[model samples]
Target: MGLLTIVTAAAVAGAGYVRARDAIVQRAQDNAVIETTNRVEQLYPLPARVFDHAALERIAGRVSGREGSAIAYGDGISAGGMDPSVITGELRSLVSSGRVGWQRVSYAGAVWLVVGMQLRITADGSSRSSGVEVYVLRPFTSEIEVVNELARNAWLIGSAVLILALGLAFLAARGVLRPVRELQLAAWQLGQGDLTARVPVRGRDELASVASTFNSTASSLEHHVGELTRMEADARRFVADVSHELRTPLAAMTAVTDVLDAETASLPGVAGQAARLVNRETLNLTRLVNDLIEVTRFDSGTAALALDDVDVAEVVRTCLRMRGFTEVSASLPDGVRARLDPRRLDVIVANLVGNALRHGAPPVSLTLSVAGSVAGSSLEILVADSGPGLPESVLPHVFARFYKADSARGRSEGSGLGLAIAWENARLHGGTLTAANRPGGGALFTLRMPLGGDA
Candidate 1:
């Protein structure tokens, strides 16, 4: 826009400069013509005598020798075979009744103002043929020089005006566009899930109004986000309280159900069958409630890590043993030890193995390796399962709380909070949890934990 404005202004200024210079030059030419006529009338006197063509030519020659004169003529006959004169007798015959007029013409590449006048006077008390036609010419070069100088100055002034206007227009455009750039950046941040983005109000104009509106929108978004976080916290707290309350009754129910199952061998009726179903369901319910309470504790920020130097290979074997699994293969290095909370490490391994076992095929591979640091080590604990890998849609949000891959397929025996809790535990230990599809066909869960005691 700035370049366009500069170009337009220059064009207009150039055209105006040309028009003004032309008009001025033309007026100078007109004035020169008028001045020449007036000066000729004042400087030369009309002669009176009965002169022939030769006498008239001699007198014209004398007058033409004067300064600022180009051509002069008289009306008479010449001596060369036929009568000859610039303003000849035949030409004078055409002006018998009145004085002749003058005209402007070009000669020798210069403008000339020509004046022709009929001279009439009495000589020796006799009105003889003494009047002659006289002409005087003046050059307009001096006047043209003045006009050219004025045109040069006009061009300079026009250039200056154009440059000034262009600079001012550029500044105005930048001032208007700067705030728009800031607003664009703020909007980009907001789209990337940064709700705190806002623009500052600068003045009491339309742009300022826009800034005010943007700030109001950001404020509303922040308020709603805070409200949602509070509601989520309350919901988790309720789940935690309810799960704790169910623990007492579930413990008693588990003991009673166990006694009934032991007497199943003595009975062969519907009552024993119903008792076995009840016992199985109660045990599943107890595990679900325990998972819920653990997740709630993590959400409420009450979870803590008790760090200790422990061999990672032992941790993996212990987790597998707790789930009644023995045939394990590991690529754990000898000194692959980590400073981590042993109990949380157990939970992370348990959840990852349980998830893989349910959704994947057998012969899961567990790898514990040391890399990246010697003094303050980093451990990579990878659990790879042979199953259909995670679908693309559910890969990114696999660690989100209560987010099931296929909710309509009914919940798995392992609660959805398992992966969520594992992810939280990894973060608490200054680590990260990642999942990806294996090359052959399966999914791999990797827990990368920082092994420094400070973490």
Candidate 2:
């Protein structure tokens, strides 16, 4: 827009300058012609009285002295200071043919007005030529100076107009784009989850209307989101309450199931099968309840870390040993110690290794490493299994509670809360738990914990 304005201004300025210059030149030319004609009328009568070259020279000299001009006469000679050759042959011929002629010429770095007049004598009955011509040279320096000054002023005024127009264009663009920039920023904030973000209303323009509409939309979104948040909180509280209430009955059931498990081998075939099923189901239910409590603690922000300087490799080994994972392959680096929550770290390792053992192929591997600078270091634990890697559809939701990837598998083998619990425990220790597919065609889970003892 600024460029367009400058171009348009330049074209207008150019046209104005041309018109002004032409008018100035025309006025100067007219003034010069009028002054020359008046001088010729005064001098023509004196030249007609004389017939010889000497008398014509005297008359020409008198005219030069009176008018402060240069005068010449005859074919190519002059009595005054001017040269006869300065007058062109065409102007001389026209004067000899009884016609007045004038021309503007440049000489000696100054503009000159040259006029040609024929001297005529009225005899007793006829008018006859005296064979003498008068040519006047008048310098129009002052008029040329005036025209030049006008040209300079025209350029200066045109330039100022162009600059002022450009400045106004810039100001207008700024005024228009300011509201658009504000709207863009408000939209970005709203996208970033700031439901309270809104633009300010200004004048009663289109932009103001847009700002008012935006504010209204933001208010509606905030109200709806507030209601949804309240409902979600209520649901979480209900789950926490139900899980807490079931603990007492589940404890008694666990005790009864333990007794049934001890007597299952001595029962009859059908009864033994029923007893085993009940025992397994009771254990699964107990694990599910515990997992729910743990998740609630995380959701409520009540989960905390108990930092201790412990050997990370030792913790990994102990977790595997407690779980009776004898066939699991392990790679440990000696003296790999870190400040972390021992209990949470144990849970993270146990769940990852246990999941691999249950769902993945044999020859599961565990690796431990330390990384980063001395002041900001971390411990990384990698657990990999030689089983089919997770399906693309299941990888994203692998840590979601009760998310079973294989629907064909009944609920007898394991609870689906293991990975989710593991992820929460890692987060409680200011760490991250991620799952991926190994290069050799298996599932890999990585646990990274900060060594700075921060939760």
lDDT of 2 at 31: 64
Task: Extract clashing residue pairs from model 1.
Answer: 78-84
**What is the C-alpha lDDT profile of model 1 across 1-455, one tens digit per residue?**
76787677778767876787678667755654465445444534446545666766554554443434423334434222211223335434544444554444566677555444444554666543335555555566776676677668766876787778778887887888888888998889888989999987788889989989998998899899989988998898889899999999999999998998898778679888998888888888898898888887777888888888898788877788888655445676676677889889999998888888777888788888866865566788899888899999999999998788888755536567889989988999988899999999899999988877355
What's the lDDT for residue 391 in model 1? 97
How much is 414 displaced in model 1, in angstroms?
A: 2.0
Local error of candidate 2 at 268, Å? 3.8
Worst 10 residues of 1 by lDDT: 78-87
User: What digit string (tens of lDDT, one per residue) describes model 2 on residues 1-455?
Assistant: 98888788778877876787778767766765566556555654443443455665665765453434555565545566676667887887888788778777877788777777766666666777766677777776877787778768767877898899889988989988898899899999999999989898889999999989999999999999999999988988998999999889999998998898899999999999998888888888887888888888888888888788998888888888988988988999999888888888888888888889888998899988887866587888899999998999999999998888997888776678889989988887878899999888999999888877677
The true-versus-predicted C-alpha distance at residue 56 of model 2, in Å, is 3.5
* Whole-model lDDT, model 2: 0.81
